[model samples]
Target: MGLSKRNRWRTLVTASVVFSLVVMATGIALANITLWMHANPTFVSGTEKLISNFEKENPQIKVELVVFPYPDLAKKVLTGILTGDVPDVYQGWGMWFIPYIRTGKVSPVPSWVTTAEELEEKFQPSSLGAYYYKGKYYGISAETNFWRGGLHVNLDILEQAGLTIPETWAEIISSGKKLTKRDSDGYIIRAGLTWINQDNSNSQFLAGIMQNGGNYWDEQGYVKLNTPEAVKSLSFYRDLVLKHEITSLTIDMSAEVHEVYFKRLAAMLIRPGWVVSIIKAQYPDLRSAFVALPSIGPEPPYYPAETGWGYQVPAAASHKEEAWKFVKFATLDKGASRAWLTEAFLLPALKSLEDDPELLEAEKLVKVAFSQLKYGRYVGDMGSRERFTQIIFNISQEVFTQKTVVKDAVAKMEKEINEMLKEYR
Candidate 1:
């Protein structure tokens, strides 16, 4: 009986060893997916939940999320790609990733995406088109932003001045003059209207150019910054600072223009809808309203500058299949997308979710913004988008600082832009 008991104990020990080995093997087989995205409270929380749900369904896969500040994200991604330490999936601005796509470093959608048309059908045309290059897609849009300029008014200031919301450009200028206040020393106590010169100069210029029926590129892809329409647009913008003196040239670059408005230093600011959330969060007691900026030249074909961010997989990623699975879950899955919309307050790329309950509720607060999207123009698809925007900003700065006349500035801008384009040609 003692010999029998010894044999039984040995059998139990062997079984325990076998079970532990199987558990270890399973752990080794599980794919670890790493994703890099801009760090935001909503994004971090929503993505954490997504990973939890995904892992539950996919027992053989584990996901790791990495977050970085918005400004630092591009540099980090470039470094990762060069060092072969890139994430399985990365979220980036469309313009920044376009160059990578050209270099064949960003992978096209998986083989499952058989055709461009199939992919296009899944997203808004303009949003998806941002990631399209040379008849191929390198990324998928998760959120689309229609960043049209809108007049953000301080209701308290307007009420104090007994002024109504401006309906036209003339009215805007007139109201600006009325609302501007100065001390006896000629120092501006409050600016009537302000534009975020440092951050949004390019977007403001582009919107004005498009509204005046100007094209940034010709049929042959030549820069047209010196066209008559462009001159009118730049001159109008310049006059807002120098000629009309509606705003002050002495700006606090450290703070965003919206922050200036929130501090009650500015009565009006022309910016995108994102400011609504910023105001609601930081200055909840401040009364603010957003109205669509009136079209510059009234005829037809008015357009507004648009920009967005999306997800792309690097070609060098070791787990493309697993990466694609996560991408689809984050962007295309209904529950995941809803969570993002509710948490992040971003516009949905998927057409079906346009009327989603969460989006519907959010839309009520940004009615003007929703209306503006119809006129939105995607700026990312343009070749050399980053270079073009920088040149535009430089030209605007020259005009604002009184360094160059609008005519001369446009001419210099056109020349510089063409020089950049020659490389692509």
Candidate 2:
């Protein structure tokens, strides 16, 4: 009786093991992977289509997408990090992932997932570099934006004034003078140039410094803001209002709030290339053009290209393999990639998509933006982007208000940034 019982137990254990292997082979045991993204209707639509196709191709896998509001998305991600409950995949701004990467919870893209040759041949260097650190790449770029050197022109306003698109800074000022309109009280009824907010101001400042042959980052990636170039950049913006008189302090032409650019209250707005998408979607009927800002110095114009946002798999994820599969599919699959680019109104990070004839022909503005990518200088690899941006914003406001002169403001900026970098050093 004891021998019979032993045989039966062995048979039962063997059968159970076989059944588990069969389930694994059929992909029945692991079928779902989770993804997190910020809320945007166009983005959500694009993702939904991509997921649908991904699921069709891999019938055994299902994707569960979790959308959060823009402001709350980072908070939710932080909570997930603390609790070790991260989604299988997370899509976020490239720079925003820097902190998480240092925590060691973000998985580096495996060699099997993407070969080095494909990585180099397919994607933009700056776009891919956003997720690179210490010789490891952590994510794939979904979208990119060159925030420097784009001068957005309201063609209707330009046409009414009988002026063509201004190429150089000298032309910008001269044309701005002609475009400015004043009321009976000498208050600005229309602004010839609109700076809008700190975001645009900071971008223009970086461009200005580069134009004047100055760099915000040195060879060792340390902050270098206390220079003549920095002061000159800040002064230029100040002069736009006080010295040049093209921009007015009272004109509330904020892009988000007033949209004075679209309303024809502003003739020209200095903005990033990606803003063209917003213009196309929101004001399709409004005639507009985006031209590269001509070189201010003898050297070529340098643009700050940031890897906007992309997808990554978490180290703590339950289904990392499935998650990576989705990430690869989302970023590399041609049809899905095209759909995402079109729906999201994003600039292409892939080399193949850069010259998509249909996309270029349909959106002439995008073509102009793409042509400017040759001058792109990748600035997304640094961890100090937010802190540096804040300092620039603060100094720009002070200078514009005349509470602080350009020299003092640049000195303050350099001091604050270097002080912040001490911790990293």
Best by TM-score: 2
Give residue 293's lDDT in candidate 1 (0 to 100): 82
Give the Cα lDDT of each candidate.
0.75, 0.77
Pairs in clash, predicted candidate 2:
none
Write candidate 1's Cα lDDT for 1-425 as tens digits: 35588889998999988766765566533589898888766667767887787776665678888899988988798777777789999877766776667776878887573357866776666576557778788888877666655789999999898999898889999999888889899877788898855446776666678877777777787767888888888888888888777887564243677777888888999776667766666678989888888876643334533446778999899899888888878777877876765554566777777767667676555666555556666663455766776787877888888899899998898899888878866
The Cα error of candidate 1 at residue 75, in Å, is 1.8
Clashing pairs in 1: none
TM-score for all models, in order of appearance: 0.86, 0.86
C-alpha RMSD of each candidate structure in angstroms: 5.5, 4.5
